[model samples]
Each structure stands twice: as C-alpha cells, then as structure tokens.
Target: MESEPTAELIRAQLRRLRLAANLTQEDFGKQVHFSGSQISAIELGQRPFDRLFLKRADEVLNSDGLLLGLLRIAELHRQPHFLRPWLDAERVAQQLRCYHPTLVPGLLQTEHYARAVIRSDDLLADDEVERRVAVRMDRQAILTRPDNPPILIAVIEEATLRRVDESFRGIMTQQISHLLDCVQRGGVLILVIPAEVSVHVGHAGPFTLACGADGDWVGHLENHLGGATIDRAEELATLHARWDGIRSVALPKGQSELLMKEVMESWSTI
Candidate 1:
C-alpha cells in the first residue's frame, strides 16, 4: 500500500500537540508567525509548513517529537504540488459556503457530467482526464465520511441549470437528481441565483468558505489559470458577508428543488 500522505502525518502530530496544550488556533497563531487561518490550513494538511513556521510551531506548541522528519516528508513528497494546502483545508472544514457561477462544483458532479466537462477541456489527454476525475472523486471522501461531514451550502447561477446540449443534458439531469438525494440526506444546501439579481457577489468565479473544526473560516478561490487558498481574516470576513447576500438573493431551497425538477423536465424535452 502507498505510504500515508506526508502532510497528513504531520497534521496528526500537530493536532495532538495543540489539543494537549488546549490552545485555540488563534492562540496558537499568536505564538507562531502564522494567521489563524494559516494555522488551520496546516492542521488540515492543505498547506505545508516551512522550516521557520515549523520551528516556531514546535517551540510554541512545545512539541518534543521529530519535527525535522515531518518537514522532510512534506518537502519531498507533495504532489498536485501547489494545491496540497487547499486540499488539506477542505478535509477538516466543518462547513462549506460555496458558489458556482457557471458549472457544478466537482464534489457535486455526477460521473457523466464530470466526463463531459473534462472532454471539453483544451489539452487534456484521456488518461489525464481519468486521473483528475479519480482524484476529484477521492477528494469527495472528506465531506462524506461518517464522523463529521462538512455542510455544503452552494449558490449556483441560473445559467448552470441550463442544458447546453442533449448529451450533456442527460448527465446534468442525473447530477440534479444526485443533488436532490444529498438534500434528502441533509448534508447539502442548494440555491439558485435568479437570472435577474441586479447585483451579484460571485461574478468573479466559483469559490467557497471552509470552516475548520476550530471554528475558523478560510476563504477559498482557485485563481485564474490556477487555484489559490486565502486565509486572511479581512478577506474571509468580506467573503462571508458577500455569501450572506448571495444566500439571501438565491431561491429558497424548496423552490430551488422544484426548479431543479422543472429543469430536468425541460432537459427531456430538448
């Protein structure tokens, strides 16, 4: 079997020390040089700790274990290599506030819909597409585990509800069906932003807010042509306020579910 992801092993140790010391992330951040969001990211395995950060954390958390060993592993083995930090954050995020302006989030996609989206990409080979899809499916495990599944609150634009082509439409319909199932299980919140919302907050692109178990929220955006994770409080607070407004303007869940049904019906007609 493959060795455990290096980031995960380090997180396990840091978490043990933090809990032992009874330090909240904010408390810990003050002792270290990181922000609370960055500390949370470290604990979540989304971001690797550089030597300076690790040394500070080791001193602050009063860890006696092998910090260097852990750091070496993280330094050498990280892949998706730029996104480990974001992925780490998602695992421990207890709540998710997300928006998709043009497409469904990967975690919410059906296999067929995911494939169609991949097939349309500019330069991906079939093997690469399959590998990426597999990775996405694996990533969904965090929000699906039995212990503490993350609450997903998503606001999707009305445009995403449209069926662009029949082949993709059937897949999307199934995806809507899956969403309805998730709603039934009480793990998801789906909202549709009206076509005529005069002002919208997520015109930029898809993004999310991830709340760590320590009750800190990390703002998320994958940058243009790449993804970046943001943990600054100033930015997170602004994003939180924007999310509240988006939630307010979006259709109510009941109506949204009904509308989804209607869209699926329309898809059959096309």
Candidate 2:
C-alpha cells in the first residue's frame, strides 16, 4: 500500500518555488490562467491541485515536471478512503460502465443531489462535506475536457428516476435536465431498467466496471455494508456478466430520455 500524499508538503514546495522565481501569487495566477484568489486557495490547502495547475506551475517555475509528479502522487492519496483504488482506476480508464439500483451515480449527480448524498453521512463536518461535494463534481471532468473523453455508460433503475424529495424538487428537476443534456452529448449513454424486472444480477447491488486502454479491467462493488474494488480476473468476469444481465433489460436511450423528461416535468408542478 502506498502512503498517502501530503498536501502540506506540496504547498510548502509551491510556496518556495514561486518565491524563488520572484513571482507573486497574482503573477503566478496570470501565468496559469487562474485568478489570484484561486492560486491562494490552492497554496493554502483550501482547494485541491489539478493537473493543469501543476503543469502550468512546473513550466512557470522551471521545475521541469516536479509539480506534475507531485500531483500524480497526491491524486492517489486524496480520494475518500474507500474510493481510493476505484479512483486510481478511473483516472486511466478508457471506458466506464456503471449500474446503480437506487440513487444517481456520483459521476452524474447534480451539485445539490451530491450535497444531499454527502450530508447523509452525518459524521462529516460542514467543511468536509463541501470538500467532498467539490471532489465529486470535479470527477465529472473525465467525461469531457480531452479531445477523446472516455465512453461512459450508465444504467439506472426506474425507481431512482421516480424517486423525489419534495424539499429539493427544483434541484431534482435540474438534475434530470442535466442528465438529458449529458446523453445528447457524444461519449455518454444512459439506460433505465424498469421496476418490473423480477430477476437480475444487479439486484445484488450497484457496481461499476472500468476498462483501461491497455485492456485491464476492475470492478468496484458497493452496498450498505461497505465497498471494495475487485481486480481478480475471475471476479471481474462475474461482474461483467452481471452488468450484461441488467443492461439487457434496460430501456433504450430514446425511451430512457422520454421517462427522464416526464420526471423532469413532474418537478415543475411541485
């Protein structure tokens, strides 16, 4: 197991390098296409370091790839405890397949829905909650950005689509609308499994499978008890079969979008 990376160390290094280069935070921000405040937030450990920022810092500070190297190590250690390995796999995956029996997948969750989901973990402090929400939102970047984004296919249960919170009706509406927009964009696919499906492998729980460009595959299985990432070929094969079982019964993209529209419209009346 690799030791967790320390943000404080990176912060110290950034401060030293920037000063050595005689660049003020504002000057550095200008060079990196970030606002001074954003740069300050990163140096203060209030915001996470992104690859782009580190790349710019490396160039501006003449440190070769030191900042980027730090970021790579930092990325591995900063994930929420249980999600560490899955995140590592996600960073390099060429394809992502997610099947959720209830609730939205984190990658597709709207900001409000993410907050609601994170708040469910009562043990987290307010700042920690906000930090997690930011992390989840940031993870969505994988679906876009690069010229070739990963192929993202999600199969959500009918119950999840129909589920609503009266207090957050507006937010739910926004979420559904966002989902609709996502499917419209290339590289994303959304399917819905109806409530009537009597038997399916997904009935066991939600799981995500990530396939790397190099042909490696991993499965992250999650339920109420806990979660684990399975890399064993035999275990991944089982999960792959289960995904096929659930996906086979799921509604096509057209129908799923129609159902999603209905759900979005329902929120308008509330």
On TM-score, the leading prediction is: 2
Every candidate's lDDT: 0.76, 0.83
Report the Cα lDDT for candidate 2: 0.83
TM-score of candidate 1 on Cα atoms, chains taken together:
0.69
Which residue pairs come into collision in candidate 1? 45-88, 46-84, 46-85, 46-88, 47-85, 222-227
lDDT of 2 at 182: 91
Local lDDT at 3 for model 1: 26
Per residue, candidate 2 scores C-alpha lDDT tens digits across 39-60 of: 8988887877755677788998
Model 1 lowest lDDT segment of ten:
71-80
lDDT of 1 by residue, 1-270 (tens): 012576577678888888889998888888886788988987786775655666677787777535645754443343456667777788788988888778888788877778777778879887657646655665677667999799998888777878467557678778888878878888889898867785677776678888888998877686556677888888888888878877888999998988888887788677
TM-score of each candidate? 0.69, 0.76
